[model samples]
Target: MNNIATPEQVTATALLLVGYAAVILFFVVRGALRIKSMADYAVGSVRFSPIAVGLSLAASMTSAATFIINPGFIALYGLSGMLSFGVVMPLASMISLVVFTKGFRKHGQTVKALTLAQWIGSRFQSTGLTRYFGWLSLLLITFIVLICVGLTQVLSNALNAPPLPVLVGIVVFIFGYMMFGGANSMVYTNTIQALLKLVVAVVLLTSGYEHFSQGVHGFLAKLAAIDPALTHATNPQSYLFRDYFEIIFCQIVIGVAIVCQPHLITKSLLLDNERDVNRYLLTAVLVLTVFFSVVFAGLYARLAFPGLQLNGQELKMDKIMSAYVVREFPVYVGLLVIMGLISAGISTLESLIQSLSSTITSDIIKPLLSPTVFSGTGGFRREIWLNRLVITVLGAVAIWLSYDQLLNAKLSVAIFAQNGVYAYFAAAFVPISFGIFLRDAPRLAVTVASVTALLVHFGVYYGRLTPYMQLPVRNPGVSAALGIVAAVVVGGVLYLALHRASVPEKTVAVAA
Candidate 1:
């Protein structure tokens, strides 16, 4: 079952591994000496260089789930899957910049300000509500971290080996450096991993295209011979328009919901200046453009190896590149592909853990321990031990969840870390957007934003409503869109009514 390695493949993989290890070690040493205080642990100081912040932002957004699950989905669906759902990055990132950057970074304040709840708490001037939002975020982030790590096992199966040890081994080694290096470690490691993934994908995909394109007529004939069903998306109706709209609607909801993501937003409030916002945005776009190359290559693989299959499934359409790469490429190329996939997976997983740490410390642990948790924000310069302990607990729980999902519920394999966060964001986007920017938005509007979003996201998702289920285009996105519209209409009317009721009619004439 193994691809018998030549000295070259082994040496290349070994060198790549050694290089990755060195990167991890470098971040680890740097973190141990300089990082302290909960603020430093969570967001790094507000003084992070423009490049570091941009790279860190890119790394945070490109999680292990993107590296692993997206390729698998591509195999199952097509390029349209990412184009339909994953294409929300520009919309999401821009909305994040516009909606949150002003509030978080307007004054260069640095606090744990990681999740949307934190922002809501900060903006509206409420502690109790903030804590509540924080705890909820903690639960979601913890789930995300566990799922991301468990995915390494899927990578193992792709490599044609036992997966548990591989999953656990990598998690431990990565988490060690991750904890010590904090945000810095996670960002730096991801930069290296992002570069590796881009390279491996480019080289491998180019080889595949060149090799397959040699006799297009012949290959086309062979492909048509393999799966005419794939000649075009026959099942597009089953999931296309429905899935497309479902994701889009939810994307709109989640697009603004990014305000809730503490890890992504934590750095926003700490920026040195307003001009840096443009620089950060550019970095995000550049990194994502490179990452999208991987997505395109994966989609193209489906086109190139139309007939390439193992046990009736096309190898190119894998959740992990290791399985497909080994089947599609030579032994030497497969090794590089494996290393690249692992690099992407590990880098994203580290960031997920970091989010988990910040969530628990700020959301669950600190709120319960010290009521006035956000008193000062030169970044999390207070409560070092509290932060680490909470992070450790979060890691332990994630390990347990990963173990359970691996042994008991295999379906957990499909749980994507970012997609779930996207759900959270999508649910909150519209309401939050209005509440923050619209002066006419009353307290009732805030209430509507929060309540309507909750109902649409959880209610439709859980089958509490019949109409949504009966509809042809029922999905998270559609449901979220309906929810956002309803909230806006209701909230707007409520705000208008409340304002009119409070004001004196004669006062207007007196002023005139």
Candidate 2:
């Protein structure tokens, strides 16, 4: 387990991954032909089965963060991490997905919206608001950086290569193809990735079965023997799982709103009919249930490395899972898992590139510069080319940020991503919620809510406003939850007041 990867191991992993990348490129090429317009690239022109879309959703939702980075948290702090990530968060997110999907899709489909910003803009009847959201969507590049770093970690570890080259290569390859493929190839690649992930998830989860040979209590005893805090329901020593509030309450609230993200929520729009909704939700929820459970593999990882050290060096919070795979699995099994991990990272990365690039091109650049610049014979074609150019720029940004995060991450890149991602979804939660449930939502209220979320989230985190934030390992979830609460409260009050005023005016006008 302590030995470094052999030459044979490195070569085999590289070959398998190259083959995987080739297959993905093939799909991208096929899908590129079908993508003539930006709309097709945004949501795919073909009518796909609900099952395939569902699997794509599952894949996109459970990314490198779920399969790679999260297990490291569980390995560090045992039961508390499991409860928060494996149970509470997933439960809330799935329920939120089911509750929000039908409403969002109905509205999104009706409006012909391709991006979350476009959907928000249409819902509020404000082009300016949509433009603002388009700018805000740039925050998601942080998440793309996260996946890049996670993938780099897995590939670097497996291939025994330096991380920088791997990081550059990954960004170039994935984002390169993504410029043309978009949603059509994205869904196809994601379905295959999801199936691979399903097998790997099973393997990681079951790999730890031997740890429970003497049953649940015995398993707990082993953790307790190493570090008593590991078996605790709430790990007071850990920043994220300090108390019930941080572990359960904050995570659940964040989870409920997490589906509001562009990549996650807009997924339902890929389906062509209302009848397919139920099957899509069913497939997604069922597959994700198993995927989330893979966090429990961290507990097994902890059991394997009692001191959390390898080769006489302290294991990093992010590298524990990679080390575990190398130390635990045999060569062939390790290769399979490595491919799955690569798939896991790439699946979500593709979605992010598609969603973010479309948002930037359609919502931001098109609105700002299209009338002035795109006034030529091949304007429509130019717009499509513009989207590709945007993807290339995004790739460069991802490489830069990912390199910085690789060198200067606090605990893991997960935290960096969560801070940016949580702020985004927190702001999005209020508008999307009101847009779906409340009729005639005042634009002012939605604007106020969105601004409030961004301010509160960044303020709490950077200001170190909370007791939790004061800890060495801060939880972004707490700040984001507070931001969402503030947005709901402020936006709700404003909406109600505006609605009341308008109601009386309409009544008087009718009487006249």
Candidate 3:
């Protein structure tokens, strides 16, 4: 394929990136000064405005998948993709976020939980369960790989550089600073990234306004001219958007559970006051609504690349957004959008690095070798350094996985990410739900539910038990939805059975 970026654009992007790195380093240094302990590192010592934390939540929640990769799906599949990604998914996630944040924050404050695993372990009073979640959190590395791939695609296309070196550079820079900054620097950086993304979202949405000169119908007519399937509510030709089940039901299920991720759910813990929760939710929901709409820009990209080819080479799904930005915009505007795309990836990448490293350090390693290995002031400092080491190891793993996906993706890295990430949240859905909602929830019930979710999700996907999985490219959403449903059923039954067994004891005590 031809280089989409002009020489001037490449030079400008390099300069823009250098300046971005300098700004990030300034914040990382500033935040590092306040990190005297792991608690400070995980939750931050600085008191931030509710609005800023809200913006951070928004930026963290809307990753490159929303801005870069999901748009590529929309570009390929059209309105069906939009309905699943832009409408149904966003609507469900926003509702779920609002519902879950308050209760989660209340409990998090009571237990002083740093990670999701800690929160679950503390709630159930089980050290073993905490360790289990710590190990299970490794599944999120797939998501880190997804973001790395997305950022590499954007940077490579904008800089007119090769993909391999670009991927390595991204992992090193982001994960390196993340080792020190943790939540302290992350909020400030995420807030800034969120604002830039808002502007870019508008620019991308309007970039194709000329396509609608004859009105909404005219835009659809244009898409229809390219391919009739593009204008359909469901694309029979596509793997993910074949019917309403995939477009609506499965998306709704996934969206509701998606917030269970460590980075997303634990964001509420950053709020120091209960009153801030309302304002935080309001800001996040409003900002996320706009960010999610950026997927509609895929429709714009489809119009730009009518044949999905640039200079005789067919565009990969992951590269579509990058190619669209470079081909459609002037150097200065394209550079700005490139920064926003990078910000989209970095905001979430930082959160994942902070939360995942913290989990491995505090929940996994510290618990395994506590009192014995981490007993004094020296051990405390050692834990902080150990967190950095975890980040370095994660960066190495991300580089390897991201490079493989860049070269040999089946369709999009989103599928691989969703498979792993979906199973995580699917398993987490029961434990977190029971922890937050039920006062006397049985740990065994939630544990069994979590295990069942993992079994069902992977079984349906690898076992090809469903028609959706039987396709050449299976839908992770199908497996995830089924897993969530099975978990709920199993957990609910066990919870009821346990409750009934305790009723006789309560009745006899009251009579005595």
Candidate 4:
């Protein structure tokens, strides 16, 4: 737990953070000036290049989990964790992203949807379902907590500062600017952050090149020498990656559904031109492929901290990457890596704030209050202010939850995040999938499917229905995958039955 960052590193990081803040504010102010309506706030008034939007999507997709947290899991469980997180998951998600983006965007543009809930409501013609999803989006607070904790870990270590003050500063600054900037500022900042992350990814991936002095076999031998389990494809000793079920199957299931999140899937809405979709997807997948490989740096960290101890204190899974950067790199390089790590967290955090607040304002609060309170031309302006207020409230809640996770994570914040975020997308998958792929999607069928997903996901998780969930450090992926499968089955059967029932009615009407 000792501060491994030297004075030079700390000072340089402080200055770099100041510069980062200044640049972010510049964009926020500029973006704020262009905002005249909720639509502008949610999707932006400025025209953005496909490449920039793609980078923003990549940055949003790769959160603190990819850069600062998941790598720690790899460091602990080695190749097994890497396969689940770094390989299988990425491939599944990228494919899912490409598959879902076009259809989702097509409908979204048709409906002029500002949030996922609106998209769902427009697709199924259900206001109740939209409000339901708007409320359900609160579950995303868990993900916000994860990013905050991850950023806190990196900044606290880099600044040689206490975690509490660091956490407070991060919440205030990020949520503050996000209030005004919304999507307009987010895309620009995310693009810059994405570029920085790309540089750091290369630096981190190559940082361990010397470990392969003899060959690839020799590099792995170094791991096996430390522990044979580290070299195994499935680690019997580990909680998450004990077998192919946990390592491969569950990850693929979770990965495909992962794109259903508001921040990730709804990113397609930012592109004004439909023709840019392919280019955007290409940029995101390629950049994300590189970002995902950053998990291998965990192996390098394990090599560096063979005992997983720094200054006689054991390293927490969440702090391993921060410790690795500070200890392994020189002052200047360490500062640069620290900035990249910060960027990784901030990029997604900004997107979450924008998307979630928009949901709360446009989808939830505005709808409920519109008849009485927002029944005029000035309603849009008031709604924009309300969105800012929502961001402020969200910032406060985030501070509370993030501090709790920072202090009392079971294994890592990733688990806490996965439980909530997994359930969200699991529930969302059915409605979104049906809306996109099926022409005559029945509202009742999708609603039943959505509720079933929530029930089954939390049921299997908290009820410990599966052997996987019975473990002390249970895998959320198990519950999420089961939930998605159950939802699809239930929704599909109901849709076919309803479709068949309506077909005979159509035939009778034609005869008449």
Candidate 2 segments whose C-alpha is farther than 4 A from its true place: 1-3, 375-377
Could you give candidate 1's per-residue lDDT for residues 1-512 as a string of tens digits?
Answer: 33324455556655766776786797678765667566566655437666666666666665554555555555445534555445664466555655565655642253435555665666555675566566556536533554445355444554444556666666667666666677655656666766777687577547556535657555445445555433342335333323444445555554555544556656555356677877776776677656645654545556545554545663433333444564566766676677666766666566667766666666667767654554566435455556666656665666666666555542224332332454455445543565456655565556656667667655665563644455433344445555656666667777778788768765777888
Q: 1-512 in candidate 2: lDDT tens per residue?
A: 23457888888988887898889989999898998778999999988899999999999999999989999999999999999999999999999999999999999999999999999999999999899899999999889988999998888888778889999999989999998888999999999999999999998989888888999999999999999999889998887998999888888899999999999999999999999999999999999999989889999989988898888888888888888887789899999988888888999999999999999999888877738566667776898899989998999999999999988999999999999999999989989999999888999999999999999999999999978888766789999999999999999999999999999999999999
lDDT of each: 0.56, 0.91, 0.93, 0.93
Candidate 3 deviation (Cα RMSD): 0.9
Full-model lDDT, candidate 2: 0.91
What TM-score does structure 2 among the candidates reach?
A: 0.98
- With a 3 Å backbone cut-off (N, CA, C), the pairs that clash in candidate 2 are none
Candidate order by lDDT, decreasing, is 3, 4, 2, 1
Compute the lDDT of residue 410 as modeled in candidate 1: 27
TM-score of each: 0.80, 0.98, 0.99, 0.99
lDDT by residue (420-452, candidate 3, tens digit) is 999999999999989989999999999999999
lDDT of predicted model 1: 0.56
TM-score, cand. 3: 0.99
Worst 10 residues of 1 by lDDT: 410-419
Candidate 3 yields a Cα-based lDDT of 0.93
